[model samples]
Target: MPVRRDRLRRAGESAFGALLLTRMILMTLLALLMVTGGAWSSWDTARDALRPPQGAAGPLTLAACDRERCTGTFGPSGETVALYQRIGREPGETLEVALRPGTAEVVRTGAPGVLYACLPLAGSLLLAGIVIGGGLRMYRTAWATAGAGIALLATAFALW
Candidate 1:
């Protein structure tokens, strides 16, 4: 009877260990997914905003804004266009912009543009940190991850 009871106790402990390992794996996968998804989604816009001006280069004259979108005119051509990202600029404000091919929108080519485009990646880092810390019990790594996100956010806001 004692032997049987001992065997049951060992089995329960092993099962608990297995469950814990499975939980850790799931959490890690979730964290990876969040980070990768954010990067994938933001890549094109962020790259366009961060790189040197290409294609059409001009001063965009903001014509009007409704809620999150602003319509403007691009360059000497006076082509009606839109700001690639939502901004707080009012009508008549002019900004240097680069026109994206196949789109009626232009991306701002400076720090402000880069920051705006990277906002999602920063958010993902923060969320990933929470999962790594609380779910995987990697406190130090989590703190580092979250710190990176905070840094990015701060830099973006400060320069914007």
Candidate 2:
């Protein structure tokens, strides 16, 4: 009787430990997914934005060019492309720009295109930091990530 009780207790202890381990693994995986998905989304958008215009560069009839950005209709696709963080050109004047592949965005030939492309990436990192910190309890790493994102955004604005 004593031996049987001992065996049962041991088995229960082992099972409890296993359960805890499983829970930890599951939570870790979820955290990783959140961070990775956020970063990937940002990277994909940035990649598309940074890529140089493909094929022949075309002209756009500027519908409006304010202090912040320029909006114009691309002649090739007849689509509106907003040029962010770029110098404003005349509202009615035609300017040459390269259309971003698979997006309704444009970049001037000599503009700082990479900085503009990275704006969304910084935002994503900031959100990911919050998720990792609040959901996963990784406070240190989360703060660091969030800080980096803020710095990037600040840099973009300053340089713009």
Best by lDDT: 1
Superposed on all Cα atoms, model 1 deviates from the true structure by an RMSD in Å of 2.8
lDDT of 2 by residue, 26-109 (tens): 766765665566567656545544554466357778888778888888887788888765444678877656776666776654
TM-score for all predictions? 0.86, 0.55
- Which residue segments of model 1 deviate by more than 4 Å? 1-5, 52-54
> On a 0 to 100 scale, what is the lDDT of residue 67 in model 1?
74
- C-alpha lDDT of candidate 1 relative to the true structure: 0.83
Residue 160 accuracy (lDDT) in model 2: 49
Q: How many residue pairs clash per model?
A: 0, 0
- Candidate 2, residue 10: the lDDT equals 88
